[model samples]
Target chain A: MTQVALMNQVVEWVNEAADQIREKLKSPIMVEEKSNRHDLVTNVDKETEAFLVEKIRTNYPDDHILGEEGLGDNLSDTKGRIWVIDPIDGTLNFVKQQENFCIMIGIFEDNVPILGFIYDVVKDEFAYGGAKTGVFLNSQSVNQVENVCLRDGLIGVNGAMFCHNTFNVRDIAIEAVGVRMLGCAGLDFLNVIRGKQNGYISNLAPWDFAAGVALSEPLGLKCSKFDGSPYDILGERQYFLVATQKTYEEIANY
Target chain B: MTQVALMNQVVEWVNEAADQIREKLKSPIMVEEKSNRHDLVTNVDKETEAFLVEKIRTNYPDDHILGEEGLGDNLSDTKGRIWVIDPIDGTLNFVKQQENFCIMIGIFEDNVPILGFIYDVVKDEFAYGGAKTGVFLNSQSVNQVENVCLRDGLIGVNGAMFCHNTFNVRDIAIEAVGVRMLGCAGLDFLNVIRGKQNGYISNLAPWDFAAGVALSEPLGLKCSKFDGSPYDILGERQYFLVATQKTYEEIANY
Candidate 1:
């Protein structure tokens, strides 16, 4: 399939998945703890992941898949066409506020991002595109963020990391104009892509940052490890930062 | 006029003011510094305040008014019927994000809250109520927040205050489940009113917290000074905190 056609198909499936998630919210939600009380998953998360996995398997049988809910194929290396899915990026907010959570998917060819989608279900905004086509929010074309200094822009932060002063995050926040935390990686990325925030910093798994990096790269954003190393597509939980190029340099140096 | 009638009138005027502000946002916004770079004001703020003040004076000329833009009546005492207005509660957000800013108005009769209205212009949600009438978000009734412990609920903190460790806010953030900062007092209050967040803490003037307190009182929220003293309705810039009773007690004691 052509890239545009494939993107359209993916968008349709995501809208369907979002519809199911919304319908499910009308009923009771059963939640379970993953690693701790802070790390949570709901029945809706599992169902959404399963539904998406089934669709991918039937349509793209040869593709490799990795999902947050572990319902997809597990691979040892980044090879061939691969899909990374985070069914619900903000499970805590999903269970608590039911509004800020998002569904994210990233398509990669040999570990290079080809296309990506981040669906903010409640807000009904789909941020999608990759390097070749450029980024977009729904039908509106998005531009690269303004290159800003650390002291001139708002930055999204992981609350726990900031509170713990992880990697001196507190100092970075102090240097920025302000800080905001939505507890959802997808929404944080959305803010940065829309130029509402200059950057976002957090400790994230591959699924948490995959789609974000795909959408951000085309907008001149810099995404890397806390120590300024390039990202490992299949890496585990690690300190991650994505920001406007200037802001990234300032934070890394600070 | 009856209390309900007054509320309806205020709601109509606020909606009109919001319309004007939205129209103005489409043009170039003229921003100016207040106290520092962090403290901002804009032409829209002044225009919105003037618009609302005109509506109030033409209708209820007997009532005194206090406004953030200083376009309203000035008085030494909180006597008689008075209207308090913050044309744009989060001017910084208004100038930066344009999505989180809000219009707020409060009605006081003889130093007691009679009605309040907080309009999130972009979301088009109006959280309005008072002591005699229960709070409502648009048309839906809003209930009191759950009395969760500090460690179990999300709390909103002022970014500057939290970073500076003002009143040991960093320690308080460490004790909560997590922290969120939206850089908008009105939106922060709306989150607490809707039970999405347990509490919010910041330094605010009378215009900043006036409408929020009126709506919160009907929903059984506890609003007080950082020292746990009762709020002074006409107070100036001070440390303010609002939350569920349990969360209030926990944060105050801690």
Candidate 2:
């Protein structure tokens, strides 16, 4: 199938799977801790990951999967088609607030992002993109917003990013018009796409960045490492940057 | 009327007004810049403020009104019964995202908070409190959540508080379980009442804190200055503190 057709199929599947998972979460779901007490996981995450893995394996037999809940393939190489999945991004937000979380999936071919989808289950909004089709919100094509300067922009940042004696994120925050932290990576990415925020930065894993990178790139945004270098899909970093063309240029220079 | 009867009446009025505002916002509303390009105000905010002001004037002619849109009284004195109002607490959020904003009103007699109301227009949820009545959510009485240590508690902070390097705010954030900035003081107060956050700190104006203090104080949460002293209702200070009983003590000592 063509890349556009494939992405359309993936979007439909994602919506269906997300709806099923959300239904199951109507009642209190079992939660587990990962890494630390702050990092959490719910049964819905594992269930959704399993469901998506099964569907992807059945539909695209040769595609490899990298999922958050350890329910997918652990491939060292990014050869061929690979699906990076975060069944429930913002697990803490989900477990605590029962909102502001989402399902994220990104497809890569030979280390190049081919397609990305971020689905907000509570709001039922989908932000998707692919190299061939550009960016879209729930099937409607959306153009890149006008380039906004830092002084006129709203930025999304993780809490840790703004702390003292760290990477000096506070200095960067002061330059922006305002800063917000919603505690949900998928929602944060959607805010950037919708022009609610001019840019977003976070300490993210591959699952967090994969779908965001795909959606952001097609909108003429600059997605890079904190130091304005190309992102490495295999390496975890303390910071990721997504910004409008004007803000990106300013930040890159700063 | 008794204080309970009067509060119930005010709650009904606020809910109806909020409903009207929400309906008007459903259609496209004109947006304009305020102090800067990043600071936005929508026609909904002005209309909502006018609606509430007119209602208060017609219903309770004796009460003095203090509102954000410059539509209310301009007196500096805090004599007599005063009604402090913010038609829409998060104007930027309302204009940009159309969610996470609220209608807030605080009624004080002789500078003592007697009634407070915060309505989440999108969710149709109301949170209120006062000396006569304890904090409540959607009419259900709610108890103050037990105090937990900062290391085990979530903190809601204005992103600027940590980023400006103004008051050693970053160090305080690092000592909490997690830090969140939702851009709306009213909604952040709701989270605190629900125990989603242990406390929040911000440099808020009178309208912003008036309703929140009404809801917070009777619930046994500490709303004070950064030094753990009482907050001045009319003065704009650098910082304000709100925390659970135990968390307040721990934070004050720290």
C-alpha lDDT values of all predictions: 0.87, 0.82
**Candidate 1 deviates by what RMSD?**
1.5
Q: Taking the tens digit of each residue's C-alpha lDDT, what string does model 2 give over B8-120?
A: 88888888888888788779989888877656788888888898888889988988988888787876777898888899998877876777799999988888898999988
Task: Pull out the clashing pairs in model 2.
Answer: none
- Can you list the residue pairs that collide in candidate 1? none
**DockQ for candidate 2, C-alpha atoms:** 0.54
Candidate DockQ scores, in order: 0.68, 0.54
Candidate 2 lDDT, A213-247, residue by residue in tens: 88888877788887877776766644788888888
Report residue A67 deviation for candidate 1 (angstroms): 1.3
lDDT of 1 by residue, B1-254 (tens): 67877787788888889888889989999999898887888999999999998988999888899999988766889899889899999887787788888999988889888888899999888999788877889978888777777777778998878877888888987777667888888988998888888899999888888899898877878898889987776777889999989999888887
lDDT of 2: 0.82
Residue B151 in model 1: lDDT: 76
TM per candidate comes to 0.97, 0.89
